[model samples]
Target: MRTLVIGDIHGGYKALLQVLERANVTKEDTLIFLGDYVDGWSQSAETIQYLIELSEKQQCIFIKGNHDVWCHEWLLNPEIENHIWFRNGGKETITSYLTNNFDTIAHLEFYKTLKNYYVDKKNRLFIHAGFSSMKGPANEVYLTNYRWDRTLWEMAIVMDKRVKKHSSLYPNRLKLYSEIYIGHTPTLHYDTDVPMQGINVWNIDTGAAFTGKLTILDIDTKEFWQSDPLPNLYPDEKGRN
Candidate 1:
């Protein structure tokens, strides 16, 4: 029973499938997805439906992302316009529903069921983004931070490497978990298409929404697998590039 942490899918259902096959994933494996599952590619709605189906027979944990929050709100009240979301890949997501068979209510429920974050038996943290409190996510004052915060990752990047984990200078947040796995900030921004480790935090989002590929990393082995770039999988689509 392996635990696999997946990165931001960003509606690339094709990329999702390829990585699963490439990783040789099995039903016994636990899939902890870090969200941004919808938006970017041309199959946003299809991706959700597929996952909803996949979860029926596979062990899956879904984390809510910023994009997912926007998508859910729009589904609940389509008349309310979120121009920011629309400008950033939301338009493509809506078009995807039109192109596919969308069960509006079921999809909305699926979104509503997503967790803000998850802590495993090993005390490892799997979150879409980051939390603010030194006390950790459960005690976070602003839940939106769980989906939008970048400071956690920023802190990890800027931390002085010389500061040991046992040192007082070590971040409290880093000290809270045995290992932190996240996906809101793509590793591509840091100039790598593979997973990057900052302190003890591992960023698995390989920019599947844009030029990079989708990735799945085994939590135990630290080994990983990737699909072709989103553009290659959806050659006719721009995929938020």
Candidate 2:
């Protein structure tokens, strides 16, 4: 059974469908979504619903992204008011729900069930964002900080650089995992014909919410597949839904 690790969908349902169709994913294949399943497009509700259906038919792992966290926060406490969420394509998500008259309850339930990370015995780690290496109980710190702490992302990048440089021989560093798949940072030249290799940290977020393609990486083979023709939902800078 092949495992396909997908990146931040960000409500690009059309792009997502195209990628899945191109990949010809089967029910036996395990799909690990790297999160940001909602917000930043016209079809947030539809995208979440599709994921829920996909999970029922296959081994699916969903991790929480910062945008997903914002969605949860908006659901639980809409009164709290998050300007950043509104500015960052969340306005469209809100409008979609409102247009459907809060029809996203089931989709919201799907997001609520997601975990922050998944690890396999084969040394494959999947997370929505970066992890923390705070020398405490390893899993505890990694999970808590990776999902909820932005500060940890900054620190993890620094630590990741150091780890990449010096941890080739150290089993302690290597023992953590052989490879990690993540999203959140969007590659500007995502659809360019550039070949990427070397580090096993595969970042598949093609930034579909921002005129980019959707991406999927086959974890075992490290073969990347992406949707053709980048989407352009947000054409203006006014942040209008």
TM for every model, in the order presented, reads 0.98, 0.80
TM-score of 2: 0.80
RMSD of 2: 4.1
Q: Write the per-residue lDDT of candidate 2 for residues 159-188, one digit (tens) a residue.
A: 444354455643233346677666776654
Global lDDT of each candidate = 0.93, 0.69
By TM-score, the best candidate is: 1
Model 2: per-residue Cα lDDT at residue 122: 87
Lowest-sum lDDT 10-residue window in model 1: 96-105
